[model samples]
Each structure stands twice: as C-alpha cells, then as structure tokens.
Target: MRAAICDDQPQALEELKKMLLRIPAVKKVHTYSDMNNFWATLKDGAYYDVVFMDIDWKQDETGIDFAGRLQEACPYTKIIYVTAYTLDYVEDVFLNHANLSGLLKKPVNQEQLERNLEKILREQSEAEGKLLIYYQGSHIAIPLQDILFLESRLHKSCIVLKKQEYLCNEKLETLKGQLDGRFLNCHKSYMVNMSYIREFRGREILLEENHVIPVSKARAKEAKERFFEYMSARM
Candidate 1:
C-alpha cells in the first residue's frame, strides 16, 4: 500500500516513515513537514491509500480541520491520526466527517502500526468482489466497493452507486442474502453500504455523496449497534 506521513516534528516524521518502509506491505511512503506540501501533492493528482496525520498542528489550522478538507478532495483515502494527545483529541477525531481507518499514539509502536495496516488490507480484500445483475439488455458487474446502497422499488431493487444507478429485477431480501456484513439492512426497504455512510442521524443516514437513506423505527437500534460494531472491529 502507498502511504503518506504528515507531521511537523522532523524526527517523528522520519521515524514513522522508516517504520512504514520496513513493512513489506507498504510499497511507497512519503513524508511531509508542512501541510501545504501535502495538500499541493494531493491537488496535483497524487493518491495515497492511507495518510498518517498529526492531530495537533502548530499553525492556525488543526489536523482535524485539514482532514475534513482532505476528505472533500479525496473521499476514499483512509486517515490514521498519529498523536501524543490521543485522549485529548480522540473524541474530536471520530466526531469529524472523515474516512478514518484508525489511530496511533505518538512515539509509534511497530506492532500497533502493522495491526492497523493489516486490518485495512483485510477490509480491502473483503471488498474485492462484484455484484452481477442483468440491466437493460446486457449483464452488468458492479464492483462491490463502489455501491453506496440498495433501495427497494416495488417489484425491483435499485442498486445505487456513487454516480450511477441500476434497476435489478430482484427482491431486496434476495440481494441482501448475497451481500457481506459490510452491507446493512438498516430498513425493510433499504440496505446500505456501511463504508459510504458519513453519519447516522437517528431516523436518517447521511451518505458520503450527500444522499440520505431512511432508517425504519424498528431497525434503528440494530443499525446503530451494527455500525458501531463495524467501526470497532476496524479500530
């Protein structure tokens, strides 16, 4: 996996980078002393699978704020906060709307770093499959990772994606049977891809692309429980 490290402390940044390089799973590692340089690299179309961010920036902007902006530009990039103030900033980091993968305490431990990396890699592997459906006149195979949610519409199910939708002549229950744990049946008529969920607002779920999915009153509690379980497993 390709990775980036953003930290103002030179020694800390290099230490993290060196540890990351030692991991065989990590193919490339980039270090940045300034947040501007990191943003500039992203703007230039550079992509990293994960970014190790420092929560406390000495400047006017904090890492949490910068991470929010980074999510806007690259929604798929996973963020891992590396900080000494884990207790102080932990709440804020999770509260923010970012694709957070995990967190690491400062003066990083090699074992903890590897565990986080392995969890992400395992998730990516699990997400590597396709949903085959007959759409229009041809058969379509949509990557499971790209799907946002599935909505039941009368006799058909609408497979919603980031930029496209497909009508499949299958019942929501039948489709749900084929999906993995990452897909949650939050409502009787809706099954959401947990990876695309931005927030859970009681009766409604806010998706990454600004789409909203209703949560049935009866299933709201289960949805919240499953979502938290999913998050905890990854962390």
Candidate 2:
C-alpha cells in the first residue's frame, strides 16, 4: 500500500515514516511538511492509498478542511488523522467523512499504528479483490471483477477483459488457484468469473463483452448448477 504523512514537525514525520516502513505491505511512503506541496503533488496525479494527517497545521486551514478537499480529488484514498487533541474536539468532523479511516493520538505506539494499518490493509484487499499477475516484465494487479475470463494459448494465459487482453506467463492452473469462488473452471482451457457471466448456453458461456467461452461437456451440469446458485445468492 502507498502512504503519505503530512505533519508540520519533521520529527513526527520521520517517526511515522519509520513505523510505516516496517510493515511488509507498505510499498512506498511520502512525507510533506507543507500542505500546499502535498496538494500540488496530488493535483499532479500522485496516488496514495492511506494518508496520515496532522489535525493542527499551524496555519489558518485545518487538516479536516484539507481532508474534505482531498476527498474531492481522491475519493478512494483513506484518511487517518493523527492528532494530540482529544477525539471530542474532532469527533463530529471525523464522523462526517466516511473515507476517514481512524484517529490516532499523538505519540502513537507500535500497537496502535499496526492495528489501524491492519484494518486498512484488510479492508483494501477485500474491497479490491485484486489478482496479481506478471505480464511483459511488469507486475499488474487487476481487480478480479474486471476480468471476464482466462484463456490458455499454448503454454501462456491470455486474460480477457471487456475491451482489452493481457498476455500472462502463468498457466490456467496457476491462475485458478489464486482466484476465489467467484471464478469457475468451465473448461480445461477456460476459467471465467461467474459475476461477468450473462448466459450459459449448454456448450458455452456468454459474457459481458459478447465473448463466448466453451463449457466442457463433463462440467456442463455442475457449471450450470453453480451459476444459478451464484445468481440466486447475488439477487
């Protein structure tokens, strides 16, 4: 996860950065002493999953006000206010924003930081339902729902989406193990996300892209049953 720390005090900023770096899941950490620089970078398209903000900015604008503006630019970004002030002073503002992850008191201990971070990471993983794959020497994490199906071409796997295709080095079997129950192995060469399935024609499955994937004769009955079960639960 990518994170940013915005604190006027340099000691507080580095302390938070050091703590965040210890977490294995954290990919990058950026710090900003000035809110203007932070906003400028975000406006220019910098992305951070979680932002640790100090409530007291020493300026006219408060962190709560800046967080509201941050929401407009990055609605998906989660905000965690690290402040010395009691929650009573900011509880009302915190409750108003659904994107705000949590509030940490000053002199945050390892336990408090890890607990909040674990929550954010777990929520992030579950919300994204990402499937990590390597293609063309680049690592890609695609949302599971975005993928329609996987088609085996020779020894490689071609990931089929609505408008694009990604060639992956992993085989169908390897990819199948990584996916959750939302995906089904319809054929030896085809593994599809049941959520994208539009219609199951005994011998094939029709997806959102109008792409047809063959259904193996052996698994046809089982596939049909599972599809209906999934639809019923979804409805």
Candidate 3:
C-alpha cells in the first residue's frame, strides 16, 4: 500500500513509520509534516491507499477541514484520524469525506494498529474496485471474476485463467490492485487467484487445473492459511 502521513510532531510521525514498516503489505509511505505540502499533493492528483493524519495538527487548517477537501480530490484515499481527541466531536465532519476509513487513537502499537489496518484495507480493496490491466497493445478487461491467480516472470506477470494466460507489464502490486477479493500473495513473486485453488501441499497449491504454484519462503505461512480457508469454504 502507498500511504501519506500528516502529523505535526516529528517523533510521532517516526513512530507510526516504524509500525507501518512491520506490516509486509505497506510498501511505501510518504511523510508530510506540513499541511501545505499535503494539500499541494492532493491538487496534483496524488494517490494513496491510506492517510494517517493528526486531527489537531498545528497548522493553518485543522486536519478535519483538510480531510473534507480530500473527499472530493482523491475519493479513493482512506483517511484515519490518528489524533488524541475523541471521535464524537468530529464524527460528521469525517463522515462527509468520500472514503473515511476510521479514527485511531495516539500511542498506537503494532497490534492495535494492525487490527485497524486490516479492517480498513479489506474494505479499501472492495471499494476501490478492480484495477485495469493493458496487454498486447490493447486494453483487456480482466474482471476480478475472470482471474484465478497471477504469477510473475522476470519481465512480465502472467494472468492465469483456467485455459489461458495473458501477459502484461504490470508488477505484482499493480496486478494486486486490479485483482479483486482475497487473491492473496502466497509468494514474493506469486499472487494467487483464490478461486482456482483446489488444495495445498507443504509449499504449493493444487489448482483446479492441477497447476502448481510455488509459494516463496516469505509468504508461505499466510499463503497456506489463505488457501486452506478458501478450499475449506468450498468443500
């Protein structure tokens, strides 16, 4: 996930950075201690999966006010008010924004943050909709429905169907956004289409077509669990 954080205190910003780094899914995070820079980026059509902002950020504009404008500028961005204030006061203001995800308290640790982060990303994935992938000098509409999973070679990621594969220039992360639902990343280089999976071995999955995808060391645990759950539900 690409994220932008707006907090006045440099220390607090750094703390949040450390916690975000622990989560494997949060790929890049940009820090903006100044509200002006935040506004400027929004005007330039900057896209971020999440925004962690201090509600009482000591700038000319309150974070809530800035969030209101954000609703129109980048509707896909999920805003989380990480202030030390009660959410009751600004409930309606944040709700006015297009995609306000949640409000988190300060002094957040890894566990507390992860629970909130999980819920928000789950919704974000569903709300942002399926992403677009272009291939063969033409734009092919690969709905989240048609995909069973995707695997990457050095230069290209192959979109796997039951009987066909489409080659594209997108990276794993780019394809992840385009692929909807629990198309979990079971390998650093392999993102599975949960629908096609039939069963799991120690580190591989049996697809409906008997295709085997090797789950990398990094993502093996999560991948196995995800594949197990998916198969169990079907059985």
Candidate 4:
C-alpha cells in the first residue's frame, strides 16, 4: 500500500513517516509539510492508497478542506485524519464530504495507526480484485468496485464505469461469471452493480448519477431479492 503524510509540523510528519515505514504492507511513504506539494503530486498522477492528514494547518485552507478536494480528485483514496485537535474537529470531519476511513488523535500511537492500516488494507484487498479484459488489443484490469454495470452490445460487452466505458470482446454471460455477489443481472442485456443502485423502481433500477437500467419481467423478482441481500450483508 502506498501511504502519504500531510502535516505542517516537520517533527510530526517525520514521526508518522517513520511509523508507516515500519509497516510491512506499506511499500512507499511520502511526507509533505506543505499541502500544495501534496496536491501537486496528486495532480501529477501520484496515487496513494491512504493519506494521514492533520486537521490544523498554517495556510488558509484547513486539512479538512483540502481533503474534500482530494476526495473529488481521487474518490478511491482513503483519508485518515491525524490531528491534535481531535475533539474540536471530530464533528467537522464527519460533517464534511470526504472518503474518511479513520481518525487518530495526535501524538499518534503506533497501535492505533496499525489498527487503521489493517482495516484499510482489508477493504483494499476486497476491492483490489480487478476484471481483466482484452480491449483495443490490450489487456486492461478494471477495478471491480469502479464498474457500475455491464451492457450486452450484441456480440460485444460494454463495461460501464462512473465516467468511462470499455468495450470488451466478450459476451455478457462470460463477464457475469467473473463478477462477485455485488452484481445483479436485472435484465437479459444488463447486469447492474448493486453498489451503484440508487433505487429499484417498478421495472427500472435507478443508479448513481441518475442512470437507469431496465429490469426485465423474468428477472425482476430475483434482481430485487439479490439487491436487498447485498445491502443487508453490507449493513
């Protein structure tokens, strides 16, 4: 796992970096005393699985504010707030929109850091499984969680994501076999990811970003049942 530490205090940043380096799962640890440098690196396409952020900063933009931007830029990257002002910012952190994983009060305890890392690692393991497909003469691995749905485009299959689509040289049935329980075949031509389902209304399933997929009469009952089952398991 690639990790990053964003704290204004040089000492605090170094301490956390040292602790993260000790963890066997963490392959790289990047420390930044300035949020600009961190954001610059992120804009340069640097990906970190988790970022330890300090709530307080000397600049006008607080860590929580920066984290919100980070969330928009990289929705999958987990954000863990490491702050000395935990009591003051705990409510704010929850209220703000971000991919929050865990919160740690500073001076960060090694045990607490490990606990957060363990949980994040477990989630990453579950989501890291990708669907390898041959597209445009290249084998591309798409993260399972990012896939919103699959559409049968005649002989070809369209892998739908939040903002992009990939046409794979395979049938929908063949792709369905590779997917896990989170996917529900709502229609003969459509397999919707239950995680992206916003609501199941009548003969249509509404997904995130207001995309709608049809639910065939034959598969309607089973699709609804599977959707509920998936939601219940997550709860």
Q: In terms of TM-score, which candidate is strongest?
A: 4
Report the C-alpha lDDT of model 4 over 26-123, residue by residue, as the tens digit: 99999999887887886655777799989999878899998988876655678999898888997899999487999999889999999999999897
lDDT of 3 by residue, 50-88 (tens): 888777866577778778777545544678877776555
Model 2 CA lDDT for position 93: 63
lDDT (0-100) at residue 184 of candidate 2? 84
TM-scores for all candidates: the values are 0.57, 0.57, 0.53, 0.58
lDDT of each: 0.85, 0.82, 0.73, 0.85
How far out, in Å, is residue 142 in model 4? Answer: 5.9
Query: Cα miss at 24, model 4 (Å)?
Result: 0.4
Rate residue 62 of model 3 by lDDT. Answer: 75
Name model 2 segments beyond 4 Å from true.
130-235
lDDT tens readout by residue for model 1, 1-235: 8899998999999899999999999999999999889988876557777899898889998888988887766555679999999999878988994878888998899999999999888866665587656676555678888899999998678999889999976556556644788998988899999998899997999999899999999999989999999988989
